[model samples]
Target: MSATALATWTVVALLGVMTPGIDTVLVLRHTIVGGGRSGLAAVGGIAAGCLVWAVASLAGLAALLAASTLAYDIVRIAGAVYLVWLGLSAIWKTLPRHRTEGGGVDALDAPGVSARVALRAGFFTNLLNPKVGVFYISLLPQFLPVGPAATAWGIVLVAIHLGVTFLWYPALIALAARARGVLLRGRVRAWMERVTAVVLIGVGVRLATTP
Candidate 1:
C-alpha cells in the first residue's frame, strides 16, 4: 500500500477505535473489577474479534451473512444472548453479600482463565457483531485499492484498527484502575457495579431489538 493510503487508514482506524462501544464497556468492566491485567485480556479479546470481522469482510463471508437472513439472525441472537448473560452475571455479583476475589492481576499470576476462553470471547464478540461486519464490508473497501495489493492493504488497515483499539482500551483500563481505589469503597462500589450492569443490559437489549 502507498504511504498515503496507510496514513489514511491509520486515521480512520483511530477514529473508529475512539468511538465507544461494547468492547469499550467490556474493557472498563474488567479494569474496574479485575484490574489492569484483566482489562488487557479484555482488550486483546476485543482486538481479536475485530480482526475476525476484518478477515470475514475481506473474504466476503460477511456478504454471505448479509444476504442470508437466517445466518444474520443466528449470529445476532447469539451475540445478544452472550452480552445479556455477561451483563446479568455482573449484576448477579452485585448481590449484597457477594464479594469478588482474585481474577485480576493476582489471578493472572496464577492459573487464570484459559487462553481459549479469552480468545473465543474476543473473536465471538466481534464476529457476532453484525454492525462491525457491515462496517468492514462497507467502510474498509472504500479505502482499499482494487489491485493485487488490495488484500494486503486491507490487512494493514485492520492491523492499524486493532492497534488503535488496543491503545485506547489500555488507557481506559489504566484510568479505571487508578480510580478504583476511590470507587471501590463503601456505596460507590455497589453503585458502580449496578450502573455498569444496567449499561451492559441496556446495550444488550438494544442490540437484540435493533433491525
Candidate 2:
C-alpha cells in the first residue's frame, strides 16, 4: 500500500479502536474491578481475538462466516448470549447479598473477575462476535496491496489495527486508574457496573435482532 493509503487506513483503524463499544467497556470494567494487570490481560485477549479474525480473513474463513447465513447466525447468537450473560452476571453481583458481604471491592471479589477470567472474557467476547469477522473480511481487502504480497500486506494492516488498539486501551486503563479513588468506591463501582451491564445487554439484544 502507498504511504497515503497506509496513513488513511491507520487513521480509520485508530478511529475504530477509539469508538466506544463492548470491547472498550470490557476493558474498563475489568480495569475497574481488577486493576491494571487484569485490564492488560483483557487487552491481550482482545488483541489475540483481533489477530484471529485477521488470520481468518486472510484465510477466507472470515469470508465463509460472512457468506454463510447459518454460520453468521450461530456466531451472532453466541455473541449475543455471551454479552447478555456478562451483563446479567454483573447485575447479579451488585445485589444486596453480594454488596453487604463486602463494600469497596468490585467484581474482582463478588463473582471474581480475576486476570485470567478477564482475559477469557475479552477473548470469547470478541471471538463470538461474527460482526468482527465480517468487519475484518470486508475492511481488510480494501487496504490490502495488490499482487502475491497482498496476504502479507493484510497482516501488516491487521498489525496496524492491533497497534492502534494497544495504544488506545492502555491509555484508557491509565485514565481509569487515575480515577481509581472515586471509581473504586463501593457505591460508585456498583453503579458503574449496573450501567455497563445494561449497555452490554442492550448491545447483545441489538446484535441478535439486527440482520
Candidate 3:
C-alpha cells in the first residue's frame, strides 16, 4: 500500500480504537479491580483476538460469517451469553455477603479470579463477536493493494489496527492506574463495577437482539 493509504487506514483504525465499547469497559474494570497488570493482560488478549480475525480473514474464514446467517447468529448468541455471564458475575461479587469487612481494596481483588480471567474475558469478548469478523472481511479489502502483494498488505493494515489498539489501551490503563487509590476505595470500586456490569449486560442484549 502507498504511504497515503496506510496513513489513512491508521487514522481510521485509531478512531475505531478510541471509540468506547465493550473492550474499553473490560480494560477499565480489570484495572480498577486487579491493577495495571490485569489491564495490560486484557489488552494483550484483545490484540490477540484481533490478530486471529485478521489471519482468519486472510484465509477466507471470516467471509463465512459474513455470508452465512446461521454462522453469524450462533456467534452472536454466544457472545451475548458470555457478556451476560460476566455481568452477572460482577454483580454477584458486589453482593453483601461477598463484601470484605469494610469493602476495602482487598474486597475488590475479584476474589478467586486471576489476571488470566481478564485476559480470557478480553479475548473471548472480541472473538465471539461476529461483527468483528464481518468488519475485517468487509473493510480490509478496501485498503488492500492490487496484485499478489495484496495479502501481505492486508496484514499490514491489521498491524496498523493492532498498533493503534496497543497505544490507546495501554494509555488508558496508565490513566486508570494513576487513579488507583481513589478508584479502589470500597464504595467507588463497587459502584464502578456495578456500572460496568450493567453496561456489559446492556450491550450484550443489544447485540443479541439486533438483526
Tens digits of per-residue lDDT, candidate 2, 1-211, equal: 7999899999999999999989999999988878888899999989998889989999988888988999999999999999999999998888766764444454334354688988998999999998889889888899887899999888889889999999999999999888876887757888888998999999999999996
Q: What global local distance difference test value does model 2 have?
A: 0.87
Comparing 1 with 3 on lDDT, the higher-scoring candidate is 3
Error of 1 at 64 (Å): 0.7
Best by TM-score: 3
For candidate 1, write residues 89-202 as lDDT tens digits.
666666654553543322212122234444455567776788888888888888888888889888878878888887887788778888977776666666776787788788
Clashing pairs in 2: none
The true-versus-predicted C-alpha distance at residue 51 of model 3, in Å, is 1.0
Clashing pairs in 1: none
Summed backbone clashes in each candidate are: 0, 0, 0
The lDDT values for all models are 0.73, 0.87, 0.87
Q: Which segments of model 2 are wrong by more than 4 Å?
A: 100-110
Superposition error at 89 for model 2 (Å): 0.7
Of candidate 2, the 10-residue stretch with the lowest lDDT total is: 101-110
RMSD each, Å:
4.1, 1.8, 1.6
